[model samples]
Target: MRFVDEIYRLYKGHFNGDEEDIVAIIVGILEEQSHQDLLKLVAEMDEEELFHMLATYMVEVMKRKVAMDDERPPATLTH
Candidate 1:
């Protein structure tokens, strides 16, 4: 998956973890479509379908962040 590899390479400087673990987490969370399947899907999409998909993803990300925050302690300045 060149797309996945490219993203990993681009952000490796900022991320610290086993590369395999990172890749596993990413591939596990996303729908298991190959790059070619993704290309076909995009090729066949109308603007409305793409927009709706993006909006749904954003909502899911926001919900996950909120849920994660609820599980953590409140932050404090430690200086």
Candidate 2:
């Protein structure tokens, strides 16, 4: 539950919908991936490596968000 809360906090503003729903969505996506390999790699990772991996993933998500925002036209102010 603590881990779920942490993930929810990390992804709060970045995703749409409620925190629980978003967390479930993320978990579902991961479950659909080649998870055996991911599990093996995670088992071999040290704490620092895990931290770096999470940080990198967050950075990539942020970059994608920025790119998507950039594609939208700026809001105009009308007099």
Candidate 3:
């Protein structure tokens, strides 16, 4: 599987019930914008942009989780 696919699979069980759209968006964005140097770009993305992207997707996944009712955890990028 691709890196993004691996991420989706790894977190599939944690999405509660809102993963489909999130996965589609993320994969779409990555496939379109993250070309051959995806890893390097991810590592070098500005803090704001990186976290924004991370938080957006996380919110999508956590839609059914009570813990996210009013809280957003720290963002992260896994290689």
Can you write out model 1's per-residue Cα lDDT over 16-52, one digit (the tens) per residue? 7777867675666356777887777667767887798
Model 1 C-alpha lDDT versus the unseen true structure: 0.75
Query: TM-score of every model?
Result: 0.54, 0.48, 0.35
Q: Could you tell me the TM-score of candidate 2?
A: 0.48
Q: Return the lDDT, model 2, position 16.
A: 74
User: Quick one: ranking by TM-score, best first?
Assistant: 1, 2, 3
What are the lDDT figures for the candidates, one per model? 0.75, 0.76, 0.70
User: For each candidate, C-alpha RMSD in Å?
Assistant: 12.0, 13.5, 14.3
Clashes of 1: 0
Q: Which ten contiguous residues of candidate 3 have the minimum total lDDT?
A: 1-10
The worst-scoring run of ten residues by lDDT in candidate 1 lies at 1-10
On lDDT, the leading prediction is 2
Candidate 3 global TM-score: 0.35
Off by over 4 Å in 3: 1-36, 64-79
Residue pairs clashing in model 1 are: none
